[model samples]
Target chain A: MRLPRVEDIEKRIPRPEDFTARSRGPATTARVGTALGIAFGICFLTGLWSHFQYSSPGWLPIGPNPAWLYRVTQGTHVATGIASVPLLLVKLWSVYPRFFLRPPKARRDQLLDVLERASIGVLVAAAIFQLTSGLLNIVQWYPWEFSFRRTHEAVAWVAIGALLVHIAVKLPVIREGLGASVEDETPVHSDGPSRRAVLRGVTVASGLALVLTVGQTVPFLRKVSVFGVRDGGGPQDLPVNRTARAAGATRAASDPAFVLQLKAGGRSMSLTRDELAKLPQRTHRLPIACVEGWSRNAVWTGVAVQDLIALVGAPSGSTVIVRSMQTRGAFRTSELPGDFVDDPRTLLALELNGEPLSLDHGYPCRIIAPNRPGVLQTKWVRELEVRT
Target chain B: MRLVRGLLLLTGLGFGLWGVWLMRDFTSEQLVSMGTFLAGGVLLHDAVIAPVTVLLGVVAARLLPGRTRSVAAIAFLVWATLTVAFVNVLSGQGGKPDNDTVLHRPYGLSWVVMTALIAAIAATVAYRRRRIAGPPRSR
Candidate 1:
């Protein structure tokens, strides 16, 4: 089938000015664009940090101290992303009128117009993908087969690139749009909502969105953040993302014969659950900060990672490869960076909040390290291999 | 300004192309599926969401009485916010096995309370505005 010409498409589609409820205009778009620009910038930077933390190169050293650094950055990343949802909607709506604008008649101008539209299509598609998929990820819902991390990072590059291009192309219009007050723009419908009212509504909507969901990261807002997926409350007042049964580690973890093995300097030593408890138990209060952004601090009681390394005659700054009892999963085995292993607070935790660990909370033993993502803190840990 | 714009455009193009290149490892099926999702998102927002929002705004503007329109709009926004916020809960997908604390709060009650509070505030503001204006003009 032959596609319709631009003129024919324009003829069928209603012009933005013709819509009775069209109160948004260039000024509104610019204002919303500014807000979105800031939000996207923050989200991008934080996202980059998170990605680097997950896939750090040997030369890139993420400091071990300031245990809350990753927590705040990842939290900001998710919060800004969620807040951008409303801003993006309003910004897109404000500019929706341009979709029906007649293409330029001049050959060069027409080519430029086509190029601009194509860029916009890319930008819009990428932005929507990043936001929606991000929200799904936080909720632990994967509807697609592609890896979320790689796809998200790749799409982020596309979105930001398109955003910069759009801004560059629209620079003149943006300046003009923002120069005048929003009220100066004439409303298409005199009896409809005023531009000021629309602005107010947008602000309210965006604020509500932020307030309703940000409590997952901001502890004070927990009660009001009804949309927060993680309530910051679980066994020992710490939320559990994956249970032992869910990870297929229940049987392996709870087996009476379960013994945690440590290998370092070609010497292997195994400790039973009771023997682990008999070892000098230390308590450290650290937060289990998940990449999804919810975090809660708990008093974790167990043996220090350094002490475990020392038991096997390993060097002071040796990296440890932690293997979990789970038969299969992406994070069933994790490597603790040398810095994390050396940190005094890093523990192979046996209890939480002064009680024995619950089955869902890595019952027998788990790795808990400072400034580390929750996924890296391997649960139901069964083996530790040291690398000098 | 022109130089900056040019630089930005070129940089943007470079990043976009690199992003596309990175997806070379993805299977054709995955690419097609992801493309569909991306396009569907844009269409959903532009076609369904924007039009519905405009229609609601128009209906509220033309039909509702003075001051009540603002109240209605605020009420509608609050309702929409609550709905979007609790979508998973409403759809019964928020719960997890052996984990009551995840999405455990009474979201329906919270929405009601929150909406009522918003409506109450809007009414109060409207009442105060009327009081300040001395009364509605005898139209």
Candidate 2:
């Protein structure tokens, strides 16, 4: 095959204006870019926060103080991601003509143009991965075999980085484009909608996306959010992500010998289901927030974690590890920070919504802490080990 | 500005390379699957979603009357895009066990109601505009 010369290639490629109904220009691109920039920024920051909460590095102490911190952040992460779907589509549409633009003739400009196109490819690919995987994750659906957490987090860095680079490169054009009025002398396709009309359509589309889906996180809008994955309704008006049967804890959870064991300060204690109920119980109207961006505020009644630690003669503020009865899964054991151990609201929850905890809802015993991720809540808890 | 752009470009390239390096730990099959997903995502958006949207818009512009063209197109686009994005949830594929809370609503009916509401609002706006203009001007 004879290789085509650069000039020949340039001659063969069509200009952006040749095929489109309107003159594809920088104005719409800048407008859409601004919206996408904000959305991507929110998604990246919130996603990073969610990642940190799981990893819990030593330097960045993720305190359980705010009580609703993870709930709000993770919810915002998923919501922003969902909102980006329309924005991204519009953004890509606005720039679709650029893909067909004739390559620059100058050697320097050609190299730069190639670099710019490559960066865009990376940005688009990473953005799609992040959004699709995230949406799938919220619905508890995994189409790919790769671990969602690592891949999602890793690609997020790629997306945000490419986004920053894109912003940097396009800053001048963006400034000029935005400065021009929406109705300014941008060429339009004789048959197509005006720029203002297109903008209006995009705005309506974005708003519709938010309104239809945000109710998964926002309490008031739950009724209207038909597309919401989590409707905040479950066994006791709270949704369950992992069921007892799914976790393979049904047998052990229902066994009469099932007792919550505590070991701390060289002392050990065991309490039956009935005995646990007799302890001083407090009620908390805290929300069970999941990392998947659904949450419900339910009345949880149980003994404070502090009180439970005291039963084994452990000092207050001691770090404790809660173990679930499920013999399998990564979250079978979870460590509570010293501060969380000291928080009075942190509980060994025995009841949810005024009823005994359903087996799938972590019956017998479970840990409920303020501002903790749902996975860290550690349902079907059987053992508590206090760490020095 | 030039310096900032250069610095950002370098940083972005660095981060992207690091991400690629991280993927080295995965098996070749996982890497290949990841690549397929990444490429498929771009293709889906570019080849299917954007083109379809543009085609729909063009058809609507050509077919719909002038006064209602923009309004109808906007409403239709909103509803259609949402339906596609939410097909899994709408079709009850998101349902799990006895948990009626996860994707429990009648999405098809809700979409109808929402579309009806949008149409009503658009009609009202058009009617008011017509009234304010004191009927269509003589051609």
Candidate 3:
């Protein structure tokens, strides 16, 4: 069939220049895009690390929870995600206009547009599910009747995959957009807000988010944190009998007495199970946040691993290894980096909710470090080794 | 400019502070669970789905003309549906969280082998096509 001639189509179409813009600015949407990109990257990495824990254990170990290490990494991952909400909204607002504008120069650009549009659809869906799901997880709420573990796992894959596609499609455009600005004597103009102004707004909002998150997480400002307390509540969150995690049963065996081996910098020392019980213990209530986006808080009591390591003569800046009675033919080890071991609040927790550790809860011994994810905490402790 | 920097700095600082606060109270149980879930998902997805998806994509691409996008979308839908089903199966036990139901095994051996095979084949086909097409006309 013969197609309509260009002259014939002109009657139905608006002028070409009407759809074209000489330049685009760093609108609020653009800034939000940048922020979303960055936040997504952080969440992606953390999520990936969380994934790696299952695929390749010890690849990136955070000290067990209630430990400073676990809390920080896990919390940061959540905080950045929370902050991304505003950032994503603004970025979408800025970039939404581009959808209406005519395609830019090049066939390659057209193809990229196709890829990017699809990616945007996927990204938006994934982000909404991931973010809201994650936030709900923090508060220990599950609105959906679906399986949290499976749905979380599936959504995470979709989200990450979409994210990768989005980045692949947008990278060049982002680079060009940024590069073009530096090259132009006078920056390009568009109908939206100026790039610099939008960026300024993002910068302020992000800063405020940080402050608020910190205020909420920091122990000193717990009373002041607008974001609320870090804990997600208590034991109801933990599985009743999640199996003796390799060494979980050992914790009970050590009840009358427990030994916590402290190793650092290639040196190792042992504390009698009873002696470990005798040491001064610290207890703090904090939330255990997972990358899967679930969180729980409980009263944790234990000798600070940092303190115990010091007592056993482990030097500062030594990597610590926490081993559980739970083993998979040598796959049951978790590493605590030297830096994390030195954090003042790192702990060798033995009690939960002011009581002795339950057998299922890594009884007798477990490592609780702050700001670290839950996976890094080794339960049913048998040995602690420190290395530089 | 300062405003932007201030914002970024503030954001970073906020992360830093939140991190520090989390550092204050540490528990081993939560970490173990988090690690388990995270690792399980990554391993299953990377090792299983990635390879299978790529294989399906390649096969579909070869069979259907101008249907690469559709094939990819199909692959994703299939994967999601399977995951939902698998996770639900796992979730049948008493009081398991919704997240743990579907296991997207890491796309491991499958991912590596499939990706390598797909890349090699694609490269070979492209090379042959270029050779046949010969020199291009100047635009």
Candidate 4:
């Protein structure tokens, strides 16, 4: 008897399992990547604008509120870049299986399939390098010999270009995907979470990372946040004693003590130059490697970054990035590798060669590292980012 | 391929451990001396290689006409490859670099060149399609 065949029975089943497998496709990753790419665009444009402002001063279009605009924009640029990390990671994971597919069902489909796969690969690689390198720069780590500062600037251009192509190529599919109502093609899956559910998870995770990262950098909540305070204390990277003495021995002689303000953990706490001198001091010799092709080792006397972070009630994390203040006018920041941040010996120095810091020598404060570039050891630091 | 992947993983692990070992062996004072050489590598790559590659790709893209798309794709491959190579060189990672250089070097640069090339190519393609659609002009 032609009692309803398996096909007929399957039609009536209305299974959720069908949707699960089908949902894992190029479009999913493309959508996720597209969102991240747009975010990347915002960060790139903001960073570039900030770079111009720093380099040329007044070249950037100044909005109505000129005073706080640079700070806000640069802050946003960094925040968004850190935030994009998880989004990029999830997007890549989503599209990884697509790389193994056979020829597409149609010729046009095949062309698109290849383009989608290629773009995803490039995007993932670029995103990883940029994010990792940028993260390292903040921590004052330069494990790789290639100029992180130059490489960062260069790769940024490349990432932007790839992102544009990725957008252009996927525009049609994106339109189609957006056009389809969620209810219309909802398929059911047996073994795994639905695509919608996975996407929601990704969004939540990325959001959490962003919130934590942003929270660490902002001045209002920084003092109490777990990331820890920067205290602008570190080994002076340059020869401040010689410089100050060379400028005028009399001025050096008159100054009984070098004064440096200790501000760390997003202005959670502050210690004036006089205050820092009153505290029992600690000195350590350290190396300063700069991506700009120079290195200096000097005795640094000041407080440890971790100690300051602890004092301000900031949480010391597994990773932290230090922004150097040496190139104040240029958007020049170096990364301290994650391992060094974990080290107990790292310091933010107040003095070099038994004298207080000089202006050219990252006066008031500079990072002194067991192994870190001078660029990563920021001078006049105003903020620090710590990630657990 | 799995064996190769395994080998690569082992090599990477070895290098990382080696770096940690070196750090542990050297006193903080000696690290400064090591940093001097390390910083030179960072500077050379950042200042010279990165900017040169970008400039080279831009010039190449301009010269190649319709071939710009392919060249742009090739350029990114070149850039990423060079980066990895230079990084390894500075880190003093042993063994010759893999031929996957073709794939790795160009990833970043390809996107830039390809985007410009594709835009120009698409515009040219569209314009040609439009011209052909109209009646031929009299000679």
lDDT of 3 by residue, B1-139 (tens): 4454455444534443443354233345544443454455444443564446446545654564331233233233322332232221123322224222112222243334434654465456545645675654433
Candidate 1 lDDT over A1-388, as tens digits, reads 8899987876887775666543567777888899998899898889989888886777888857798888889988887887777678767867877787877899999999999999999999999899888877776777787888888988898999999999999999889878868674554344445566667777887788788878887889988788778778887778998888778999998898999999986799999999999999999988888888777778999999989989989976888999998876689899888888888799999999999998889979999887888888899999999976
Give the per-residue lDDT of model 3 (tens digit) for A4-44. Answer: 99868756644333322222234333345666777877876
Docking level of model 4: incorrect
Ranking by DockQ: 1, 2, 3, 4
- Which lDDT values do the candidates have, in the order given? 0.81, 0.81, 0.53, 0.49
The interface root-mean-square deviations, each candidate in sequence, come to 2.4, 2.1, 16.4, 21.4
Candidate with top TM-score is 1
What DockQ do the predictions score, one after another? 0.48, 0.47, 0.02, 0.01
Q: Which residues of candidate 4, in runs, are more than 4 Å off?
A: A1-23, A26-31, A57-65, A104-118, A182-187, A223-388, B1-139
Q: 1 or 2, which is superior by DockQ?
A: 1
lDDT of 2 at A16: 74
As for candidate 1, its interface RMSD to one decimal place is 2.4
Against the true structure, candidate 3 reaches a TM-score of 0.44
For residues B1-139, write the lDDT of model 2, one tens digit per residue. Answer: 7898888778877877777766769887777777888999999988898768767866876886555665665566566656655755655554456445566677788878877887888778766756776754446
Tens-place lDDT per residue, model 4, A1-388, is 7799877875764332322234455556656666787788887777666555433344443322222344456556665766675576556545444433555689899887886666555544555666656654543345565554444555566556556555555565666765554332454332233456445555654554454334323545432322211212233323121122222223422344643323334545555566666666778765443322223346778866676656655554434555533322343344444445445566667787788865556566666666332334566543444533
Ranking by lDDT: 1, 2, 3, 4
Question: What C-alpha lDDT, on a 0 to 100 scale, does residue A168 get in candidate 2?
Answer: 82
Docking class of 2: acceptable
Per-residue lDDT tens digits for candidate 2, residues A76-169, read 8888777777778777877886778777899999999998899899999999888888877777777787888888878888888888888888
Query: What shift in Å separates residue B40 of candidate 1 from its native position after superposition?
Result: 0.9
| Candidates 2 and 4 compared by TM-score, better number | 2
